[model samples]
Target: MTDYTSMANGGLPRISPYQAGKPIEEVQRELGLSEVIKLASNENPFGMSKKAVAKCAEALNSSHIYPDSNGYYLKQKLFEKFGYDPKTITLGDGSNELINLIFQTFINNKVNVVIPAYSFVVYPMEATVADAQVKTIPLKDWVIDLDAVYDAIDSNTRMVVLANPANPTGTAVNINKLKEFVKKVPHETLVVIDEAYNEYQKEEDFDDTAKWIAECPNLIVSRTFSKAYGLAGLRIGYMVSNEEIASLVNRLRAPFNVNAIALTAAIEALDDTDHLKMVVAENAKERDRYVKYCEDHNLYMIPSQANFVSIDFKRDAFPIYDALLHRGVIVRPLKGYKLDTILRISIGTHVENTKLFKALDEILKSLK
Candidate 1:
């Protein structure tokens, strides 16, 4: 019998596939529910900007033509809006793809990769696929221990990964401290910071890491329109680094890597500042409600600057997660991440959140 698994790349066969949050339609079909609200994937509760949506529709007319291979217009938009250097930018299908590209470009079995615990999961996964040695650093009080991560790096370390307002835990590192860490890292090791939830952070906590690219040539910053910009389905993102790194990653990027509609929508999305502001403001308001809910219920809600909250049940939470699912409220269970006692729930609109609270109240009563 043919053994295809043995022929697979490094750790591909040994690793489990990424389990994304279930779509509303899939839950409806599986459970025979008429209505379901998904608070699993940390997507923007508000849909895409009206301007972006309109642009996407208009772009449908050009579907037959290939998108600009280099995404020139979108790069120009980023440069105009954020003062990013177009030469330092590399377009990606999503920040996930850029992460993979980084590992593929630099990582090898002889080198090691440093990552903090409770990260985005893609970090270690991509490193493993690249056949790199993985170094997992422990968190300090539920947040990434930057100092520990620094100590883990050695000459053989090829990369260090961090996610600001990190996933699952929703805890972020102080920006000033992060800058210091980046400066101290050796020039030989690449520092990758995934800021997918950057827009959701408070104004006081935000700082543009891309500005440091010139000073720290080994630094790479990746961001996406998936969360705050509300373009998850379009899968548009970009990476910022020195021109040398950008050029290397570009060589591996597929032509027309970004589709025409995504490019159009992303360009418009960057321009619609009002819509982005509303999404961030509403997310802040609703996120507070989740904090209070946890406090009132005697649960611990991790401090989150992102658009989601992770509550520690202090015991296996699968039962509670299942109950919520049956009641037409879908939230993330962290069993796969080995954080079985915690569940991460995305902030939704007011009405949706109210419905979730009501359903949760009923479920809690039944459990007691």
Candidate 2:
């Protein structure tokens, strides 16, 4: 047999794959636990909207038919909501695929992508696979340093990816600061704002990148149905940008990239305002409760506008993470993001949160 390693692109050789949270069934199998509460992945605990569920069921009956290549109905709904032309929208399997498509469209061996040192890892990983150099700007107080990012940009910089309410940290840049930063960036460089958690933000002053897209021709705002809409399993996300940029990205996107059921469900999800409000309210209450719990326990935690909170253990988080898992509570350790002392916990139902707190209390007591 031929050595396929040699046949592959040498520069793109051996990339580390993303480690998603362990499934409940897998954990139950491994630990022999009956009940498991997953406070990982920042998923909506309430599950998907009823309207979306109904729409998905209707679409599933015709699952044999191929999905619309253009995602016409979904795009129309999005157009009404955001008032952007259908030409400006490009749907993806998820926002992650949209991220890769952006890189594939513009990035090459010569161009480099700039990302925050502690921002989403996908940007750097995808850039590496494209054989493009990656410039990582260190975080300031667990938040993205817009000034530092601007300083890092040079002539070879092709794209800059910012995850507002960034993962693992859950910090966000306000509207004014983001606008100033956007104004300073070179027009030739594409600024991709990944707003996957946009629905969870309670801040009145949050950056509205969608409005800025009209002014900044180089800006792309990507949103996902995974978080607030409770459609993570369906894997539907879309990008809004200028027609020219969207056209470039569309060229690289596969036909029927989004599935038929996902498209129908996402359209219905958009109309489910009551479900969205309930999710936002529940998440807010749980987030505040978690923050208070951390405070009472004297655990340091980053202030978050997103659904998850990054709690500092003041020690290696992996051990505590393992302890929590053994207690049937699953949370994410941020060791991969260089914050070994922090664990990111997604907000869950009241009972689930209480169980997690109880587990943490027991583990901490044992450690002491």
Candidate 3:
């Protein structure tokens, strides 16, 4: 037999593929259960706006033709809504793809990428794929240590990944501290802030990094339609950077990276501000409910600004996660994030959230 592994990229063998939360069908199929609820992937349970769906339907007529390679109309819509320069924005299949492009564009074996330990799994995976030596700074408590991340920088550091309202942990650094860190970072190194859950943040005066793009040439802020906009299936996302860096990132992006239907839906999604607000509001209420459950049950929850809450079980959570699966519900296990005792639960609809607590209560009681 051919040695296919030998022919693959050197990083392929070292990489563990990203583990997405299990889909509802997969749970039913494997467990032979009729009812299943998935609160695993941090998707908006409210779904996207009716207008976005209508726009998607309208766009189907043009599906035979290729989507605009440049994503012109969507870019214009983004500009009008947010006032970001079209030249400084670049669209992608998802922020995930744009992340890979950033790594491919600037990373190399000679340089290193700084990341917070137990943060997003993608940063380390991409850094390894780019063959860049990764320098991971462990989180302080559950939040990214901005100062330590600053300390990790050196002449060979080409990029740093910062997730605001960070995943898994769902905490964020103070804006003032983040600004100070930005000043300390060498202007030559790119600071990539992955804000996949930006909309869910309820903090007053949350940093709008898009406005920082011009002054901070090295800043790259990425946002997606997957969460608050309920476009996870569409996989549409984009980044904000100075024109030069955006140009470089664009060079690595494939033509027509976002499809026509996605672009149309994204454009319409922006116009449906009410729907976005409704989703964000619902998330806040549900996240609070999860927090209350944790408090009442003696579990510790990392105060979250994102769509999920990371609860420390204070013991191995694998059995709990496995048990929850059999009960016809799915939540994210954080073993891959090096937090084996924590489970990250995405804020779902009221029914889904209540079901989770019900199952968890029974599981915890049995364990006791």
TM-score of each: 0.99, 0.98, 0.98
Stretches of candidate 3 off by over 4 Å are none
Q: Which prediction has the highest TM-score against the true structure?
A: 1
- Which one wins on lDDT? 1
Model 1 scores a TM of 0.99
Candidate 3, lDDT over the whole model = 0.89
lDDT of 3 at 3: 91
lDDT of 3 at 366: 98
Residue-level lDDT tens digits of model 1 in 1-368: 99998999887876789999989999899999999999999998899999999989889998999999999999999999989989999989988899989889998889999999989988888888888899999999989999999999998998999999899888889889999999999999999999999998878878999998878999999999999999999998999999999999999998888999989999999999999999999999999999889888888999999999998888788998998998898999999889999989999999989988898788777877
- The true-versus-predicted C-alpha distance at residue 159 of model 3, in Å, is 0.6
User: What residue pairs are clashing in model 2?
Assistant: none
1-368, model 2: which lDDT tens digit per residue? 99887677625675788889889998999999999989999898999889888878888999999999999998899888878789999999989999989988988889989999888878888888888888989888888999999999999999999998899788887768889888779999989999999888866747568779778888999999998888889898999999999999999999889999999989988998999999999999989998899899999889898989999999998999999999999999888887899999999988999899999999999999
Of the two candidates 1 and 3, the one with more favorable TM-score, higher being better, is: 1
All models, RMSD in angstroms: 0.8, 1.2, 1.1
